[model samples]
Target: MLIWRLQKRVLNFVHVPPPHCGVDIVDAIYKCLKECGLKNKVFTVSMDNASYNHSCLRFLREIFSRNRRLLCKGKLFHVRCCAHILNLLVQDGLGEIGHIIENVRESVKYINQYEARKQTFSKIVQQLQLGTKKLVIIDFPTRWNSTFQMLLCALKFKDVFPRFQGRKPNYDYLSTPEEWKNVEKVCEVLEVFNVVTNIIFDSDYPTSNFYLSEIYRVKEILNLKAMDESDFIRRMVGKMKGKFDKYWGECNLLMVVASVMDPRCKLRLAEMFFPKIYSEAETRNNIEQVRGDLYQLYMSM
Candidate 1:
């Protein structure tokens, strides 16, 4: 995919052969750029945080620099995929509640497998007078956001589940009362992630400046929930916070630069919020660094 002049489009669809290593990826990318006569026009590459991608960038930077086409010595050449990072964070949290998700997922699958079961579940929904028209969703294991949606939808029809279980007499995946309570709390926590994920994935506009603020909101949620009275919530949030720090504890320089460039934020956002995420001394140093980087980038351009 390529983004040029605010327009995004796929420039090549090369088939990567077995052992898609960094050299192979760079070969494919270089071939495409050469064919398009764009070898010297490239600015940056946005990719997921895969280890091989780092290798790919290193090779590409060397090639571009040898040709004297690398801007700012390729300091801003790699942009980590934000959506992918968000997925890792949520998946970390979900790992702590796998059993609860499995039970809900299995219950949904059982209900969806046969027409008779679907009809019976529908009838139970009617009898219980559940005020929702949404059905239980069977989420795939790979997509954590789908799991979030499945849990959110299932919670709406949670009362109908017991009624359906009573009729079947053989159903085994219905969550216990305490488990249901946990699911509700987890759903509340995941709602913020869901909303921010949507905002990040929005394709109608450029979202770079929006990232730092959304990420800050997520940190606030994790820190607040990590101190909750419920041991379950606290434990779950602890795992999530660990993952969050692994990826985002230190500010990503590119993201901070973008935030500083936004007229609305423009240093003030960093000044106002850095203290919340970092110690006073670190915040002061970080703000100064970002300010200096901003000026250096402008001068280089």
Candidate 2:
């Protein structure tokens, strides 16, 4: 479900995530909207009845109350995310875990709540500085929490957490064997999303970062060329070859998945998930020799 926000000719979209940062279409829409105008595009606001907070109705209520003009169906609108609805089924019986999870969550939170403890912990960490960086910062702190939690509950206070002996429970009682496994899953999914977010935040993150190091993992998995194809796809893809095998196939299936944050060309980029060449591809004199049959198909067509 989505909140289809419109203000005169200007439209704004926003979302809350579930079933894993799931609103992945807005990327393609933003990319596509430029060449084509968005005046004719129809909006579907993602919604879910189970989530009363971020629902389409709540979105409408908030906006329409602020400005009656938004009430018009021709302009701003709201819809629910089907994936969220599907997730209701996925999390159904598991709702009981929320309270239990919260209890454990608070237990972990208690440690981080005190600044002195956090500082002491940081000092301890600096002593163990195996990496140049102390933490991996993410938009969502789930992984960070898990890492910190294990450090606190299990490993930290083992013989009194201050001892800092081993890796287990080093976070606290927060991360469990179960949570560690889930953390891996969250990392995998979040890693894909972080890549997508980078592409979506192209203006901010810049494609240059993507040309270097593990940062290229997303571009490699998404098999995306910059909106301008500024990066070397063949070379970058070669470098990131096996690093992305985990999410590569999934991205091929879900390139259309983007956020409602920027819907411009996301849909069109979704089309690029397949091998179709853009009509505007520059044709070089050497195209015939380099492309052979591929060139023949284009020329014949």
Candidate 3:
């Protein structure tokens, strides 16, 4: 495991054993923090969405809650990894059109599997003068974002595929026009997720404040697509919305307060966005509640 000290610009890597139970994981973290003289100074721990990790965090929080010197009383101590949640959301959406994606996947695998086929594809690219030597990318089924990239790269060589198929009449996995259109639509949605993931995973900067705006943007985009005229897009986005709401409908208050703390946004941003996301009454109540949370945070500091 790795621990980062943002202010001091230090990163520490510690060796941990396998078969990590909740108690074992929490004990490792506690011992590491105590050794570094930061057990009481920790305010939050960010981890992926695994059941064991959740239990480990809960155990750690319980331990810290018994300590009198800990500030914030461990109220904001567990942050679910945003990138993992984004991956889950996109994966769920991909399931809506899994068969279409599998067709594309198989075609890519066929083209890249043999050296002779790759050579033939290269000749086609040269004959068409596509002006680049980029090859089709084969995506792993488990990685949805990689699949998006494979489709994106495949689209660039869309014109060459038909001619190549003509030369090899036995290859029948070529995508039809409608299938290509579906790929394009799926790429459009996944691209937004790709950009957000890149922004959040930047190692050089703090990204906590960006969570509110980025997630709000995703929710708005999904809502707009849910109203799309295309039945396929609407159905796909509906599934995505269900997964998104399952994880993010009730986001952590610390992230909300962090957004409000931004000087350019302040409370106005919350006031503007809450109404769009919540009911009239709930909007008013949530905004007031966030204000109270912010006040308490300031006083505690």
Provide the overall lDDT of each model, using Cα atoms, as 2-decimal numbers: 0.84, 0.35, 0.81
Arranged by lDDT, best first: 1, 3, 2
Models sorted by TM-score, best on top: 1, 3, 2
lDDT, candidate 1, residue 112?
86
Is candidate 2 or 3 superior in lDDT?
3
- What C-alpha lDDT does candidate 2 achieve relative to the native structure? 0.35
Candidate 1 contains a number of clashing pairs equal to 0
TM for candidate 2 is 0.31
Candidate 3 local distance difference test against the native: 0.81
Any residue pairs clashing in model 3, and if so which?
none
Model 3 regions lying over 4 Å from their true place? 1-19, 69-73
Candidate 3, after superposition: displacement of residue 68 in Å?
A: 3.0
Which stretches in model 1 have alpha-carbon errors above 4 Å? 1-5, 69-73
Native-to-model Cα distance after best TM-score fit, residue 70 in candidate 2, in Å = 20
lDDT of 2 by residue, 1-301 (tens): 8544434433445343544322233333343454456523434343454444344345434533554333233223453332342223213312323332343454445446666555554556666653321222211233333433333333222222333323334454444555444333333423444444445343433232222223234444434522213233333233333333332322221122221113454333333322322122322322222234333323633
Best model number under TM-score: 1
The better candidate by TM-score, 1 or 3, is 1
